[model samples]
Target chain A: MLRSQFHIELNNMHVELDKMCHLVIEAIDRCVEAFQNHDLELAQEIIRNDKAINDVERSVESKCLSLILKQQPVASDLRDVSTALKVVTDLERIGDQSADIAELILEMDEKDSYLMIEHIPSMARVAIEMVTSALSAFHEHDIQKANEVKKHDREMDQLFEEVKLELVQIVKENKDHVDLAIQFLMIAKYFERIGDHVVNICEWVEFNQTGKVNDTRLI
Target chain B: MENKIVAKNVNLHYGSKHALKNVSLDIKENAITAFIGPSGCGKSTFLKTLNRMNDYVENCKIEGTILLDGEDVYDEKVDTTVLRKKVGMVFQQPNPFPMSIYDNIAYGPRIHGIKNKRELDRIVEESLKAAALYDEVSDRLHTSALGLSGGQQQRLCIARALAVQPDVILLDEPTSALDPISTLKIEELLLDLKDKYTIAIVTHNMQQASRIADYTAFFLVGEMIEYGQTKDIFSIPKDKRTEDYITGRFG
Candidate 1:
């Protein structure tokens, strides 16, 4: 309680980061839904809202810089500020990947019939769950939850491979299906990259909690 | 590195007030070890003990073994003058003597019976250069020490301490009274000095400790609370009390 003003500013920064996490999570959710139902309007909305996540990232980054310059936090306070700075990068990238998926969904031909591919949606669901859990782990400071998110990434990778093989089979069955299959493949890859971003976020959560990244102490 | 100074089960009392608990730590050879805590935490009291500066305090009682180079410093037969020469000290303020700068640097050597003028001049020049103050004041060596700026005076005090070529240097808030640039110069000088002398500092500035110390010890209420590598202590301190203090959450 000694540095109450510093604590207040640090808490405000945490709140801003939390808000950014929520925005990124929503983008992932809405983009997946838009991809599944072929809702062009919702896809456009998610793409537009990606800017909000970027703005929050910039705001949180500025707060962290100010806290470091003015308060000169050390120990866990230092770790928290550094982790926030790194986490926002991953969160912003997650938002970008989600927006990229929405863009790919918008590029789908109206008569493509690729929406029948079940594995792509499954990958999207898993990616969304991993992202939610990773950010939650950061907010809650739960290393166990962060580790679980890391483990879940393997499942995401497997789903991506399945989607790739399924699309390849559809293209082999009919050369005319190549265009739609390739678009679906690109969407699955975006989800896969989102999974990687979630893993990075989880790593940063571990760093905030334990001051280590991938079992190596950074300080 | 080897243990240049080892203090074991050290306790001190000024009359009925226990100023230091059973403190024990090793000052590594040729490395900067910083002691940090809030005011009146006995960090300076403990620093004074290293050079037996507390012997002058009335009603002071000390119980411990302080070893310097494997020899007990408190042993009755140990010459206090020689022991003091081996463990020189600097105070919080820039306490330069009211004499010329050349005499201030030459005072300790003169006391130790070095009367040769050429030898004294060499010692003065080497000490000033070692303290990183030679270039600015070499031409004004005979000028009064008090006329120097606050930062320059502090470094001159450091030069005075270095004139005798002590094996270890103990500083208590050496830069608290100076400007930021002066503080940084002293810090840089300490970093450079560690190659030839073991250094222990007592400071209230946690950032200063983190910046220059190879090792850091946190003291609290006459007790040594925690000690470790500076990186580990500042990043992931094992004790919550230490974490609270370093993070400015301690009341």
Candidate 2:
């Protein structure tokens, strides 16, 4: 087979993997919106519907692994599949983490006032945007965009630290809210980790395309 | 670090076929350099050239020079036997001699006329210990080397090479035939030996190359595609062919 044909096939598979990333991100986005509005019904529904995102992660992983094992994909193709594998693993964990937050949302009653309600959803949005843009960079093979993702991760890290501080203050003020605040803090931390993972995936995309692995912030 | 054996503009041919084309590599003293590529890519052929093992093959001709410790190994005055003694080799399969472990370790030393039993015993013990296997087989040195496990046999072969006290050791897919545990043992042993012996290994396993080698040379279609530090080669290979091969594109 011609090299161009092999490359075209790998490009097609890359698009499919990108679509899978989109699916999981959209799922997490939905859960984020649900948790923000204290919509227990919607949060519960998102928790119940997480299987679809999980399924995409599995399918994409299988596709990438098969391409690697069978086609012996060349430079860019190998990078794409390897990045897809790591990204899907990260996205899958994000899906579960979002579900965890949704479960917390389900337990809280409608009347309870969150310690840092304003910060949590906004933090989630930033985290989601980080993943979204990182995936966009990967899909376009844009190193500049990946670098932007790295920059925005700083915001997520700062927000995580702020939230941690606020939760600590709330726990000290009212021990009754300690459990809820701790759970919320864990959710925020998971989102922060998700952001970090997205940055990692972006680094892989750069490494795949340029053969360079960039060192990014851990948080 | 300066290379003990340096190959400059090296090329090789097997009959009408080119096996290596313009491959220039520097293997540092007391460092492990791994050559990785797909099958039939001339990694083994290149490894064989270091000690002129290809001299045994008919119609196999080489161009360019290989230097050993700043001296030309391929020089007409340099005895191939003497060169082989300075550069020891271990093959893919552990072809232990059809003799006991004692004889296997003693074979080369004995050929060189080291007849003192006490000295031979010390060499055997030290070589086996250097290969990290003295304690397991010190009591059973009289047993046939083949009777040991595959990993132990491979280590015994390493001990045999160490007994010769070579300056450089070439491993041609030495762990390819062994189990995972055996592969790990050999890898660990190589790591330990790197501080004392200049080691060159040809392997198809990229992870192995990354794990143990200080320098990695990627070969493709009888050409040196890229050669660099292992971290740089794995993380950011300059050549597209290198990136393709290391990331598991083609064999």
Overall lDDT per candidate, in order of appearance: 0.92, 0.83
Tens digit of per-residue lDDT, candidate 1, span B70-178: 9989899988899889999998999999999999999999999999999999999999999999999999999999999999999999999999989999999999999
Instruction: Report the number of the highest-TM-score candidate.
Output: 1
**Scored by Cα lDDT, where does model 2 land?**
0.83
For model 1 chain B, where is the 10-residue window of minimal lDDT? B71-80
lDDT value, residue B147 of candidate 1: 95
Q: DockQ values for all predictions? A: 0.90, 0.15
Query: Any runs in candidate 1 off by more than 4 Å, and if so which?
Result: A110-115
What are the chain A TM-scores of the candidates, in order? 0.96, 0.86
Look at candidate 1 and tell me the lDDT of residue A53. Answer: 98
RMSD of 1: 1.2
**Which window of ten consecutive residues has the lowest lDDT sum in model 1 chain A?**
A109-118
- lDDT (Cα, tens digit) per residue for candidate 1, span A1-219: 799999999999998998999999999999988876788999999999999999999999999999999999999999999999999999999999989988987888656553567787689889989998888888899999999999988999999989988988988989998888878888888889999999998999889978999999998
Cα deviation in Å at residue A2, candidate 1? 1.6
